[model samples]
Target: MARFLLRRLVTSVVVLFGLGVVTFLMTQVLPGDPARAAAGRNATAEQVAAAASRLGLDRPLWDQFAAYFGRLFQGDLGTSVVTRRPVLDDIAQALPSSVELVLAAMLINVAIAVPLGVYAAHRRGRFADVAARVIVLLGAAVPVFWLGLVLQLVFADRLGMLPLTGQLGFGREVPEITGMTSVDALLSGDLPAFGDAVSHLVLPALTLAAAFIAVVARTVRSSMITVLDSDYVTLARATGASERRVVIRHGLRNALVPVSTIIGMQLGWMLGSTVLVESVFGRTGIGAYAVTAVLQNDLYAVIGTVLVIGVVFVLVNIVVDLVQLWLNPRLRQPARGAAPAPAASLAPGAAAEAGPAVKEGAVS
Candidate 1:
């Protein structure tokens, strides 16, 4: 485990380095003058020149990159071209909102996906299973922005059941313990504020969770089906274990190992997708911040946003790997210079052949 963790940390550093370099080049390629964007449209040519010099844009490309990279070590992300505030400060304020949004979406995904997927696997060819499959396909197929719009129209505009945009209703405020409105509200013991915050969150969270739900549900369904058909599951059934016990203890428990992996990987994708969701919902988050930075050609702000996302992705993956190790103890054993364990098949008496510890571990 120590060796694996060290390798992961090294790989994460390499990935972040590559990400920073690529983001810098991509920003350089964006069409527009960063100096002019920074100086404003009405600024004279001399002022633009001064801004260029101040920003180090007047230097050679290699010097500019060196300066930018060096500043990173000092925890300086420079001032945003649009906001004229430190880019790092802006990111600190915005990151919590995106984290809150993504976490809420993941909670919804797990709540719906696990039960729905398990039921679908059990039902197999029934009408309910077919309907679940169709819903999953549609959720995956629909674009997030379009889904957010439809949800806003139906739930907010037409039905007036939810707020149209923003994190809290007008005149509803919570003392900011965290940038996340819902969490801050609860922390401050403001039930009304918390309720309002949650209502605003419903549409955006659903929009962000749609694709993730589909992906996770499909994975759970498939994994459950495979586990249910395994030799240990069959032996448990033959030994007069209740059906629910067989499914939950022997099947779902083992199947969740792969689902944990899928959830972690999907989080990385969801970070990117949050851009569209926040745009449609008009939420002030890192995604919305990135959109503004891109449109205004704010080089430092854009790079900062990508760096934060990349770091979060790497950290989430590390946690997931640890969870996987816990779920499968075999992963903890070094594969090098180790004899292979015998694999069991689905044939009768395979559980007995595999040994008592293996049989109990499979079911317990």
Candidate 2:
């Protein structure tokens, strides 16, 4: 297990390094000059040249990339050409809102998808299954921005029940705990502020979660169906296990392996999808910042954001891999006679061997 973890960590680092190189190269190849963009249309040739020199844009692309990577290693993300602010600071400020939005969306996705999937699997040929399929199709077909606009119109304009824009109430100043307005409000014991934040978050979160929920539901339902037909499930049923118990215990637990993989991949999809959702909802987040950086040709900010997102993707996948290994005994244990146990395995054979068994039972 320790070796497995070390291998995964090393792989994650390599993947992140590759991502950084790709991002840096892509930004370098982009058409517009960052110095010119920073200087604006009214600036003279000498001004643009001076700005380029100041930003090291006048340096060779390879040298610039090397310098960028060097600074990155030291935790410096450089300054935004447009905002003139440290890219790291900009990301730090913007990341919390994006994280809050994505977290809420994922929560909504899991809450809806898991139950619907289980139900659809259990009622495979029934109307419930058909309805779930239809919902999934519609969710995937509709664009998030359109959904956001429609939701904003109905809930905010027509119903007049929720705020149309922003993260908080007009008069109340919500604390910025952890950078997530909703969490901060709750932490501050400001229930009213929390409620307001939740209200505003509802439309955007639902809009973002719709497609993810569809994907998760379908994946889980398929996995569940497969698991239900397995021998253990049949044996459970033969032993007079209750229908619900057989389905939830023997079936769902087995189905989690595939479902969890999909859930992990969905984190990346959710982050990518947030760009449009944030724009439509007028939320100030990393997505919005990324958009602004691209439009202004702020290469540093763009690269920094891409690097941050790539790191997030890699970390999430690593966590998922570890969780999967923990949940599935087959992943943590070697096949019989496949290889001799590592030294770490022998030190506490009795205790260490029990780890997989305990994890399996816990997950199951």
Candidate 3:
């Protein structure tokens, strides 16, 4: 386990380095003068030149790259071209909202997918299974923005069942603890504020979850079907184990090994999907932050956002690897060091000497 963790740590560092390099190159190719963006449209050439110097943009590419990484090592993500504040500060402020949103979407996805998939598998080939699959297909096929608009139209504008946009009502307040409105509200014993936050969250979370729920459910359904047909499941059934017990205890548990991997892989998907969802819902999350940064040609902010997402993706996959090791005992076995020497290739003298011992041990 220690070795496994170390390997993952090394791989994560490499992944982050590659992400940084690629993001830097991509930003360089973007069509706009970041110095001008930072200095403002009406600024004189002198002001733009000063801004470029201050931002290290006037340095050689290699020098600037080195400087970026140097500041990165010290936890500074440089200044945002648009905000004129530290990019790290902007990310810190927005990241928690995105985290909360993604987590909520993931929770909704797992809660619905697991049970629905299990039931669908149990009723495979029946009308229930067909209906479940159809629903999943529709969920996956729907565009996130269109779905968000439809949800907002029906649930917010028409029915007035939920808030139209934002994390909370205009004047509603919750103590800023975690930056997650609901969590912060609960921490402050503000149940009404918590309720309001959740009401605002429902539509966006649902829209974000719709894209992934089908993927997860389909994975679970397929895995559950395979597990159900395995020898152990058949043996359990033959032993008169209840269908629920056989399915839940024997099938679903094992099926979750693959499902966990899929769920972890979806972390990136969830984060990416938040871009569209946040825009439609008017949430000020990292996704929205990213969109704003791109529009304003904020080089530092874009780089910072990509690095953060890549780091998160790596961390989540590591956790998933650990979870898989826990769920599947076979994965916990120590890796084999080397192949044993073939008996046929052994020295004749050693083989003769070992043959009697082997025969005696077998007889005993």
Candidate 4:
């Protein structure tokens, strides 16, 4: 297990390094000079040259790339060409909003998907299953920005149940504790602020969660269907175990391996997709910052944001691999060293094999 973990960690590092290289090259190759963008249209040739020199843009491209990587290795993300603020500081300031939004979306996805998937699997070939499938299709088909706008219209404009935009009500200051509005409001002992934050978060979170819920539900339903037909499930049924216990404890546990992988992948997608949702909802987050950086041609900020997201993707995959190994013991064991099967695979008194043997064990 230790060796497996070490190998995964090393692979993650290599992947991150490659991602960094790609980010650097892509940012460098993008048209339009950051110095010119920062300097504005009215600037003269000398002014542009000075700005370029100051930003090390006048240096050879390779030298600039080397310097950027050197600074990155030293934990310096460089100063933003537009804002002149440290890239790391800007990221730190913006990260919480993105993290909070993604987490809320994830929670909403799990809450809706798990139950819908379980019910769909339980009601296979019935109307419930058909309805669940239809919902998943619709969710997957709709664009997130369109969904966000529709939600804003229905819940905010028409129903008037929640605020249209912003993290809090105008002029109502919520103390920043953890940078997560909901968490910070709760930590500050302000129930009203907390309620407001959660209310504001609902539309965007739902918009983001909709697509992910569709993915997770389909994965869970498929895995559950496969698990439900296995031999152990038949044994549980024969042992007179309650249907609920058999489904929840036996079927669901075994089904979660694939479901977990889907969820992890969705989490990484949520991070990237939040950009569109954040823009539509007027939320201040890394997504919003990234958009601004792209508009202004701020190469440093763009590269830094991409690098952060790439690292997150690599880390999430590693975690999913570890979870998969933990859930399926067959994956963790040495394939060549496994003990031989018994001569009689089943008891003489036992009924005929009711189903195929499950290759993977239950997921914790």
Residue range 1-364, candidate 4, lDDT tens digits: 9899899888888887788788778757888777786567679899899888877888998998887788778878877877889888998899899999999999999999988899999999999999998998799899989888998999999999988988888877778878999999999999998999999999999999998888889888888898788766776677566889778877887788888888888878888887898999999999999999988778778888888877788888889998988776667766675564632232221223322322222221
Tens digit of per-residue lDDT, candidate 2, span 219-336? 8899999888765565556556588877876677767888888888888778867889899888989999999998877887888888888888888998889888866666776667
In order, what lDDT does every prediction score? 0.86, 0.83, 0.86, 0.83
What does the lDDT read for residue 103 in candidate 4?
96
TM-score, every prediction: 0.90, 0.89, 0.89, 0.89
Model 2 worst lDDT run, 10 consecutive residues: 342-351
RMSD for each of the candidates: 3.9, 6.0, 7.9, 5.1
Instruction: Give Cα distance to truth, residue 66, candidate 2, Å.
Output: 1.8
Tens digit of per-residue lDDT, candidate 3, span 1-364:
8988899899988988888788778657878887888888999999999989987889999998898778878988768877889998999999899989999999999999999999999999999999999998899999999999999999999999998899998898987899898999999999999999999999999999999999999999999999888755665565566888788887888889999999999987798778899999999899999999988778778888888888888889999999999988767676677765444332222344345554565588
Return the lDDT, model 1, position 164.
Answer: 99
- Per-residue lDDT tens digits of candidate 1, residues 1-364? 8999999999988988898788778758878887887888899999999999988998999998898789887878888988889999999999889888998898899999988899999999899999998998899799998999999999999999999999998877788888899999999999999999999998999999998888888899999999888767876676666889777877887888999999998787788778999999999999999999888778778888888888888889999999999886667876677555444233333354346656676688
User: What does the lDDT come to for candidate 3?
Assistant: 0.86
- What TM-score, to 2 decimals, does candidate 1 have? 0.90
